[model samples]
Target: MIKVAVILTGVLLLAAYLVLLERKLLGRFQARIGPNRAGIFGLLQPVSDGIKLLTKEDVIPQGAHRRIFLFAPAVVAATALLTFAVVPMGPDLHLGGRKIPMVVTDMNVGLLYVFAMASLSVYGVVLGGWASDSKYAMLGSIRGAAQMISYELALGLSIVPVVMLAGSLSLVDIVDAQAGRPFILVQPLAFVIFFLSAMAESKRIPFDLPEAEAELGSGYHTEYSGMRFGMFFLGEYVQMQVLGALTAVFFLGGWRGPFLPAPLWLLVKIVLVVTAMIWIRATLPRFRYDQLMGLGWKFLIPAALINIVITGFVMVGI
Candidate 1:
């Protein structure tokens, strides 16, 4: 129970810091100053934001489905926290005369664990949207479900080559295979598919159609207020960080570095991956809904399937 509490606390802390990093990165990229007033370079922005959300008045729509509405944000946040359980930050290090690995729970079936938890996370958005009894919320939920399901097919298939090559579904084993040579080199197409699908799954910039502001008026969580609204927002950013960590574990070689200690190495790799995500967000414009759907089905899926076929033949020939 203590370990669970500790892991949960750590995840919350990491998620808070990630929001600051994203803001700072976006500010720099856009040539506009970010939140420097709250704390050091707006380091206190998250802190202040949390306080504000906590103190704000809670507003539940009278016509809304009350039970599910109360449950949605909590479900999303819990799912985000659950994923970190299997995320190994580094090798065991001796601290205060005890060796401790920086992961929560590295189950034997790490790959399936992540996929299962990831599938569960989408339900929060769908449920929240439907419970709101608003057109925008319904549309947003529908879009979220369709988008997640569509991309997950390609996303799941694209990573199969990595599994086949490594001959293990364990994330730790996958990292081992890419230790000396990153998977990005051998499976370039898979990397692209994994990356794009990851972006869609996380619902950032180009793939964030469900929450499109101009069209949907804040989309699914528009009816939510107070800490409830905060949960959804924070959960999205945390999901971004979690997905970035997964990318590091699967492709960038998790905690595989020299000179720096293992934990530091893990942090460095995650920062790089998260920075790239922010860069992509700043550079690309959001895709139209229909265009987004078309690209996923027509381009990404086909390319990922080809990547798998190519990898199979190459492996058999060898």
Candidate 2:
């Protein structure tokens, strides 16, 4: 238990650095310098940000539900880290004469665990908006709920093909089976669908309708401040990292590469995916809520279904 706790702490710390990396990368994407003013090349920006948020004054809205407001951010942050417990960071490694799996849990129903965690995470959004006692928060929360639910269905259908091909739900097994060939080649369409949907599920770019600044004023988190807001901020970036890692694991072939150790391969794949996400954010304009919904249900979901059908047919013939 202590070991699990320690590893989790390390993962959270890594997530913090990831947010800083995203900002710096975004700066490079936009042809501008980023946070090098903070510390040596801004390596310490996340640490500075963490300290600022923690020491800032806590603010509750005039009529906000104080207890619910306080609890919502914590819930989101906790759930985001929990999903990583099942992700295989590397092949099994020997530690002190006992082998420890890189992942925290090796469930037969690993994919299902991800879906379940996603579903439960909605409470954080719903609570955050309701507890804020503000119209903007409510609207943002509603947008978040609708967006997540719509994208998740497509995300699930898309990945079903990979699971079908591998004949297993264990993440580690899926990676091992993709030793030479990545799932991206077998299901490129599904790969596109999953990547886009995961972005929506994480409330990132084109799909970040909930946080659309022009319309929502910081969205569902408008009323949160201090560590309450910090938790949500951390949760968002961690969610991004988790989603990027999932893209690598299920499609890009987790921890599989030539001339690189398993952990390095996994990290390299995840960083590329994360950079692509940054590129998308830098290049694409935010989608209207209606347009976002239409793309997910009218396009992505059906496309994923078709991909699954084709995959099923191919596997049967083989």
Candidate 3:
């Protein structure tokens, strides 16, 4: 219980700062100043943002379903935080004559659990949009659901090769399986597929058709106000960190490196993945809705299937 609390607090704090980091990086990418006024180099920017969100007036539309509208944000924030429970931050540490695993929980079906929680997050978006009683919100939510469902297949299939190699669904086992070398070298295709699918799943750029502000007027959370809206924002950034962690665990070799500590290595890998994601956001244009669906269903899904079949045969041959 203590471990769970600590991890939850840590993840929330990290999520808050990640928002600031993204803003700063995006500003630099766009050749403009970021949030440098909040504190030295915008160190206190996230704190300021939090206060503003919390202090803002909470408004509910006249026709909105008040109960579900209020509940929806909780679903997003909760599921995003829950997915981190099985993620291993480092190897086991010996303390007081007992070994303590770095993860909050070590489940045999950790990977499945992560994906399950990810799928549940769509409900929050859908419900928030529907309950708002707004056409734009409804359309955005529908797009979010379809996009998530489409990319989710590719996301699951992309990791099959890793599961095959690791011989276990446990994330810790997956990390351990990479003791000698990371999976990226052997399963580069899976890495690319997983990364792209994950970006879509997180509802970020190039795949952010659901939240295309120019078209949908802020999308699913169009009617959300104050910290209620902030919850969705928080969930997105936290999910981004979760994706970074998963990419590190599955491909970059979670918490495994020489000279440096295991946790630090894992952190380094996550930062690299997150930075790449940010760069993509800065460089690429958003895909049209049809283009987004086509890429996921036509290209990524089939590619992942082929990768899995090839991996299976190679394993059988070996």
Report every candidate's CA lDDT.
Answer: 0.86, 0.88, 0.94
Instruction: Tell me each candidate's TM-score.
Output: 0.95, 0.96, 0.98
| Clash statistics: count for each candidate | 0, 0, 0
| lDDT for each residue of candidate 2 in 1-318, tens digit (9 for 90 to 100) | 765786677668777888888888888988989899787999888889999999999988889998999899988988888888788888887979999888888899998998888887888998999999999999999999999888999999999999998889999988987987999998899899999999899988878898898999999998888988999998887788788789989998898888998877887887788778888988899998889999999999999999889999989999
Candidate 1 lDDT: 0.86
Cα lDDT over the full model 2? 0.88
Task: Judging by lDDT against the true structure, name the best candidate.
Answer: 3
- After superposition, the stretches of candidate 1 with alpha carbons farther than 4 Å from their true spots are 1-3, 93-101
What is residue 286's positional error in candidate 3, in angstroms? 0.7
Task: Order the candidate numbers by lDDT, best to worst.
Answer: 3, 2, 1
Q: After superposition, how far is residue 312 of candidate 2 from its true place, in Å?
A: 0.7
Which residue runs does candidate 3 get wrong by more than 4 Å?
none
Ranking by TM-score: 3, 2, 1
- Best model per TM-score: 3
Candidate 1 vs candidate 3: the lDDT winner is 3
Residue pairs clashing, model 1: none
**By TM-score, is 2 or 3 better?**
3
